[model samples]
Target: MSDLLERLRGRGWRLTSQRRVVAEVLDGDHVHLTADEVHSRAVERLPEISRATVYNTLGELVCLGEVLEVATDGRAKRYDPNAHRPHQHLVCSGCGAIRDVHPQGDPLAGLPQGERFGFVLSGAEITYRGLCPECADRG
Candidate 1:
């Protein structure tokens, strides 16, 4: 992904081998990987890449808006690379699988006017939890 590298370079990020491996590991559709998971994948390509470097690169990506960190169960945050569009998450309560789902209506539309509490709200996060098909069939 030359374009991705160019964008990262434009942001004044150092283009190191470890960073490139980390970015490559994260590129793809519907990829939601934890930091440890990303480190594991990146290590396959660059055997000497450290977990700390992976974490740092991931944090930079999140700050750059190239990725989103999602913590569905208050555990280790998962990094989602689908930052090109606004959307929500659907997580399987059983197996911790995650998917993107579009709800029927604008989710923020239901926020009560009184609930504003004299504060300005910029955004909302909605996570729908349910059993994935495989997990549902297993039960």
Candidate 2:
């Protein structure tokens, strides 16, 4: 996702070496990495990268709308880069694995007009939980 990094650069972001490392760690399809997990990976690349820096960079990325925070349940939040696409998440209840899934229709349509409470809703997030193939087979 050099494109994302380049966009951030064009926006006049600091683009510190630590920020660049975190961005590269999150650069992928269907990658839902938690802040701790991200820090862990970043530490491998640059041992001096502090947790605070990672958290700050992630918050900045989210503010820029380049990253989506996927909180699948009440656990650790995962960072998603598929912000340009409209899709939902399929989470594994057993292993905590996450996948990007495009459902059949508009999920927001399920909210009937009567339940709207007189407010215009623009978007919706739906989380589907189930056992992944590997987890299911283990049982």
Candidate 3:
């Protein structure tokens, strides 16, 4: 946590109470939280924190490559804090639950050069959609 704070400070980010609370809420593995969820959790520690502040902090974290913004289903973007490694996502189509998953191979390797269309493709996102165990059992 101190490492993250130091990195943020080195990047010219102001270390405010609201930003600290938001960062604390986002520190963990497999954490995928929406801005509202982040605000709800941050309020538990700092009641004065505003939703806008949480959103702004999240945006800053994303810009710093400290977090990943996942936009699945064209709905609210979920913020993922597992930026230490490259991976993919597995989404529960029924309940909107998300989980980080490692694909069998390099996802980018599947993109052929012909599809590049003379454009340089730097990255790709692969999301596997299926019914989660709980949702599958319910159906």
> Which has the greatest lDDT?
2
CA lDDT, every model vs. true structure: 0.82, 0.88, 0.84
RMSD in Å for candidate 2, one decimal? 1.8
Q: lDDT tens string, model 3, 1-139? A: 2245555667787777888788888877678889999999999999999888898899989998988899988878998887767788999999999988877887777989898788777777888999999999999
TM-score, candidate number 2: 0.89
Q: Write the per-residue lDDT of candidate 2 for residues 39-58, one digit (tens) a residue.
A: 99999999999999999999
Between candidates 1 and 3, the one scoring higher on TM-score is: 3
Clash count, one per candidate? 0, 0, 0
Sort the predicted structures by TM-score, highest score first.
2, 3, 1
Any idea what lDDT model 1 has? 0.82
RMSD of 3: 2.3
TM-score of 1: 0.86
Best by TM-score: 2
